[model samples]
Target: MNPRSTATAHVDTFARDRLPPPDQWPDLRFDLPELRYPDRLNAAAELLEGGAGRPVFRTPSGDVWSYGELRARVDRLAHLLTRDLGVVPGNRVLLRGPTTPWLAACWLAVLKAGAIAVTVLAQQRPSELSRMCEIARVRHALCDIRCVDDLAEAGVPGLRITTYGGDGPDDLLRRPAPSTPYPAVDTAADDVALIAFTSGTTGRPKGCAHLHRDVLAIADTFSRHVLRPRADDLFAGSPPLGFTFGLGGLVIFPMRAGACSLLLERAGPRELLPAIAEHRVSVLFTAPTAYRAMLAAPGTYDLSSLRRCVSAGENLPAATWRAWYERTGLRLINGIGATELLHIFVSAADEQIRPGTTGVPVPGWQAEVQDAHGRPVPDGEPGLLAVRGPVGCRYLDDPRQREYVRGGWNITGDLYVRDPDGWFRYVARADDMIVSAGYNIAGPEVEEALLRHPDVVEAAVVGRPDARRGQVVVAFAVLKEGAERDAEALRAFVRAELAPYKCPREIVFRTALPRTATGKLQRFRLPGDGYAESSAREDAGSPTGRETGGDRQ
Candidate 1:
């Protein structure tokens, strides 16, 4: 079948089986026991053992490794780690590099060697790496040659470093490959399997530790209900392996299903599409922004093999979803996950997708909307979204853990509303909500409205401090090609569609809005370096006579 025809068939099947009614969605529940591994539980031995001769991973450089071959290489690497690198059980091993088959193998090897894997972003600077190493007490570091200098600059004491080939001493790459297969050491269900650093929007990064059971729980929950990858399916994506999103999509989910995967040395939209087309990749996982870019790319690429595409990291706008489906005939399944959760907690399977909402909580997890005082809020009322499942989050020596865990629920910083039928709709981060003249406004709602305009390509909403009114909504927008940017005209357009108070009080045009690596808009960085000065000027110029607007909008 042709690409376009196959795309149609896939979408039709998904629409019929997966698209649940917005109001008829079922509540999430965890009825199964938490997954506990035997002390000798190693993912490589568990998943890749029987498929020794089967093709497992294909790299862009035409390097194809079979399951048996990959396992053999992992054995050598694991032996070297323990014998030469002095790595021992419970030791924290820091891995910093781009996504590659070797990196994936290294991750499993770390776990096989009974060490806690701490994956750091390759793009992180010296200062960032140093702080994380100190916080995690990482003693061993492995990175690509490109990132070696930064690690050196970080000055981690007693840190043993190993560099991947493509640079550095060639002799180091010639270390004798160990032949003996490493035995799986006993690992407890609650023993730390991984330590992922949270994206610190509020303050310093916090290490969120996940147990061996958490890894299995994620696969049982989101992967079982949402993805359902088959053994023959090929999983591929753009998130760096260090990120939990990537860990689940590229490694744990596929391994759990005993499937193959393709790992790109560099993952971006440009690189990802070509890999998918070239390798006939079946499962695609990435953020919404990358999907939008793929839709906008000039050439037509064959994406016939893709049976599933998952979107996470940030909210998936309805417009992006419609555009992608219109082009590819596949609805991007939206999911919301955090480092604390280890994998996606809220998601829609191919059979139960809702366009704008973040979908229902995954089975085996309980989610509810609550007020500030931890009281359950009425249905349809926006409240703090809290979740609890087999995979409980434990922060390392952080007092804020108290604020996050109320009773047994982990309070995600997001504000959301649950419809009477059970679908959960994302509103805004509690800190991102703008209160203007007593009105509570969600920036994303305004941004979504703005995106509907043909001229707007991107938009970010932030609250500018005001003296008369506590805060006022201000919008930063990037115009589409050939579109004009007129602040007054844009404000008038918003007023026509939304309530007057919810409309932006001011609009500022920019080439692009600042965003985190995960594609979340960094509202704190919106005002730039002059933010303090701008706020001072606005406070001084505020009109003194207004107190009429109530918080009813």
Candidate 2:
């Protein structure tokens, strides 16, 4: 069967026409029976069915919304969008706000109403948001009442902005609703559902267009096969709904499993621990840095309720994984996923876990290590990680699509070494590889060595231009409070663990490492100074302060 889906329900056709030519698309397979969807499908409608009486979302304000209640809320919002806001099938709707039930509901409503959702983090500045809007040609927005300033400042011409979560007469939540039952838009399974924008090193936004079928495929493949959730489990996480990671772990995955999830607007490590025990959360999803911060914190959190914990966003050092296991008798499930592919395509759960290595691909996906020329590399050799599955990257109107999707494989740009036994160990991003005097050094290997130190709390390694060597390994570290900043001593510590050439000759200590709002390191933005910054970490590195979400797009 020709997998090309030619039929679409999009009336706007803007996003449809922008997709790369059919020849550039990655191979999409639906080997699993559950993955086969009807020609006409609505992802929100499929998920919101049959779990009426169970709690689906809970907030810190003691508000618990059941599946039935959430369905009503989404239907009402859908009605408002189509009836009052003039949204039609295939129109793009920008959703900007902190992570909350209202924001999640808005996302579902947009899909149900046959409108494409563009969910961006609240921390994104006006310029970043504007660029994404321009790229997606967004003409409508539903923003949180408190976060409207930036969207208003963006001032995209002809864009209609509606404020929600306020008492104003025009607010989405307060507006009178139509009493008629809102019928779900019967969209083709292959029709574009949302446009998620992810940035590359050049900071250029690439819009990934995902179909309605792709939404349920991630849940069926990863959540169903690996991070299996029970209907009675209570899920929680730190990634914002804008990120595919959070959207999967917190919303889509749970809803597909008939489970409940607690949505916290501020989900930093310090704030997350207490909320978990208070809410009796069973499954937790966050980054490796957050786990280390939680371990370093002084408080005695009642983490007995936590049954499963998943980590991503950065490589999980074996030391941190062991420490987390020692402190709490739970194994940290480490997985690597990309916004292009939606969620964690490679991960392990329960008995399938192996520390320091990302597990095998999920049930419906296939992964391999390939050289630059797209030829298969030998075992234990580092190469670009290529994956193809039920869902793949379809960058909207971007030339990079040819680079990302090569010969029917989605090249994730991550370097990995696949062992004979099929366990994939992450090396570093392909561009992040450092060549010092012709000796190739993966930044993550050096980072793991630094993280093994007793005083180092957070570490990032990058290459600096050197006169003699083309590039030299440089390490930026955030140490434990009151730890002495002795570059020589730290250097010696790393040399003891790694080869002398692979070790960082110079170390710069800092109070915290810089990260994106979605809690990812900005390696290119690393400062070259040896002095420590006075202020604490901005987003994720600090074990203190309140911040939320992963740079999840």
Candidate 3:
């Protein structure tokens, strides 16, 4: 099972060698025979080559790019990458750009040229990009013209960079290519296609290596069985293309079904509502926080065209789910996915929807709640959530791989409780659980209780060290406009819904809670001196300061 055997002849073998030991990897299961891919597979060939004349992408400004047009553009870009830039199969090409038709073209071109696509978020600072360059040993970058300066600031030695968009002479979009169409390379299904970095909650981000087959496996399992997108359905979302959530929702899922995807450069809740109405977007992918924000301006936009609304990135509280359903009569599709698994493994569609629970495992995967001894916990008990599917974690050269994969399952870091009927209820992250006076307190459970208060706009619960107790549950909350900030009253509100031990010992009022770009809460920033510093930073510039709804997973 040497990973190197499947790598293309032209790629750098460093990544292949860095994969987790064969024993540590989970057994990939493709229950559906069609999920079994060929020995030599090029993902771009499947994503871009098959669709002939259907509309593929549309910009916010109303420009449309059909499948035929996008295919020609991708072929030309692939030719330029191989012929002009000497990019051979297996070389890692960094792709940095906002969500746009050209950015999609660049990504597919890199894969079509038989190179691994390393997608970096456009908002990432130089320091972050510099660290990625070091870890992946990336040497070439295809970036937006605006990000060219940041790439230079990274100061990676011998790093070659190309720019797209803008009126520059050497713009990647305007570069000429040889007339010949560059056929997709024949890469092994197991050959690495992308190196998606995890959100650095602890320390440096770890790169997750995904194979050519893994890309389509997610589409087949989650998209095919659960979401069930149609060719005429228009997909849109707020997630940046760099996020696996966005990669699946905005690009891969749509292309897999020959559906059209609307590309919006700035897709916050405010922007997304109008785009959904104007473009008649059918399937929506976003976090719970965005769904909460959009609930504010009810009846402001025509969202009748939206049939399916998917929520992930964090836990979806039952309150938010109820509020959204009450407002639009559309049940929110709640699922939990991680960077390692590629996309949602557990989810229920329209009729099977459950408000608070994160549904059963998708058709191609198996899940269970495990205790510290690596044994399954009884129903109604909380423990680690472990899953095995066609796609799982393969951290590139990281020792933490041993901690993530145990036995034959990928142990997702979240803590959960499984009911007798097998629905998984999220409690908190393994690290976010507060051990106070020997009582286990799930922070999200307390946060959900606080969110039930009409005056509470947003809330984040964390464990603050206490002298009498090892740690006490403390909450930072943002109140609605003109609402009084009475800590005792808020504490009483929470006590009414939860046990006294689970209620927050103290409530701190804040303009906003710190969250990541993808909208996940930053629990680590809540305790100790970090609280004051984060509060000050939020007060100074966080946009969510005036807005309700904190980011979710």
Candidate 4:
């Protein structure tokens, strides 16, 4: 659709009278001010100055760093980068390591020294790291000693590699002492502060360039509206510092709120629980899978200190939310954020939450459900989810920039429904929808229903190509411990709970479903040749009449 035509159509569907004016929303005090220098707006500089001599972070090892001490360390590293390493403004410095107070300091040091920081996931493979370095033209990489070997194997040449850990030449512990405080360089608002590489399910990764102002814009909108952290609140989470979700949860929001962040060197479900218990962490940010895993842990960990738990990266099932709140008094705040938006555009505070819904859009953003042609759908009808927020995403020279931004609206790949009261309920992605015999099915909806089953530990539903039907619903299930994986019994259970068309045509038992590093289910990996092999074995052993089930139309 043409740009002008699309805009006109969108306006007609969501007329001004039909939607509430943005100004009528509750005022959030965290909005970013227009700065004189856009390119050099360093968050570390702003927060450190305001929070000087105050505690910034706490570690489980009984280590604590006041803002003054953190700034002093950052200054020393900044000087070393400028003098010894010759790093300059706009230089892309790749930060590779797990979350640590030192890692946070290094991030600020790089930015404080006037260089753009590109955070690489510590768990990323050599090839993935290589692609990122090549795309960003990273001049320096501060990585863990364990990751240095992979960086070498990735063939990223001419890049200075600094290692962290025991006896390493460039260990953060051995960095030179600071002679003076590093001064913040003047930067333009449009200058890129960080580049986050998004995992592409279709093609090579794309770097989402976030401007300095964009950082504050996110903190202004979602953080103010959803989190509302106080100085006494200690924020922590399981997402690595590399993910924007973690960066916001662990550093930006807390620092913006003048609160302390607890940085765990290792953050998995196992590690996260202990850190929370030991440190009395009040706020958490993690994926739904991690929350589920924490509940499944063999031993009980004291989580009473936790006041707010935020879940993103994937759809939050109602069953997961109920299970979490029932076990612990905290409700998992469901927010929908994309790499483009930098943070969640929609979220609900604990008091305002509707269990399964993706909540109302933040004060500064507008969301609508649109049909295939980009026309807004009626309330309660599922369609493409489009959002327009203060923090706009500008891709680095990618054609997708044009495809994503249509008529001044960001068309997220997600499909959703907007209720009359304006709550947004997430459906499957437009690309992830399964079509069988002309029936359009959302995979996530089926997965959500399956999760409600007591015997089901985890399930991923995908479309499998069929000769009779265009596609058939196939479920990859991981049953609970001591639970039976009998195909017929499981199918019977699904048939009882879901519509005949929505029930899985076949159930394939697996030890576990494959997931991305961020804990999102990797549905693309399903319905591969492995499924065919498993199907062959199942069909060969099954009796003739048993193959056709009541649920199979």
Model number with the top lDDT: 2
Q: Which stretches of candidate 3 lie over 4 Å from their true place?
A: 1-9, 528-553
How do the residues 418-485 of candidate 3 rate in per-residue lDDT, one tens digit apiece?
A: 99998888988887789999999999999999999998768888887777888888788888778887
Scored against the true structure, residue 279 in model 2 reaches a CA lDDT of 93
Model 4 lDDT vs. the true structure?
0.74
Candidate 1 per-residue lDDT, tens place, 119-141, comes to: 98887778778877777778788
The window of 10 residues in a row where model 1 has the poorest summed lDDT is 544-553
lDDT of 4 by residue, 1-553 (tens): 1111111111112111221223222222223343222333565677576467778889888898988788888888888877877877778889988788888888888767767789977877787888888777776888777667877778887988888675956675676656797787565444567778777523666777775666777777788777888888999987777888888888988888888999887777889988888889999888888898898888877888998889988899999999998999787899998877788988888778999898998877888888867799999898988887666655654555656666666777888999999999998877778898989988888888888888887888888888788888888777778887687777777788778898888788777776655676667666532345543122222211110000000
* TM-scores, each model vs. reference: 0.87, 0.95, 0.94, 0.88
Cα displacement (angstroms), candidate 4, residue 412, comes to 1.4
- Model 2 residue 500 lDDT score: 92
> How big is the positional error of residue 177 in model 2, measured in Å on the Cα after superposition?
1.1
* CA deviation > 4 Å runs, candidate 4: 1-40, 166-173, 528-530, 533-553
What is each predicted model's overall lDDT from 0 to 1? 0.74, 0.86, 0.84, 0.74
**lDDT of each residue in 137-182, candidate 2, tens digit only:** 9999999999999999987888999999888899999989986657
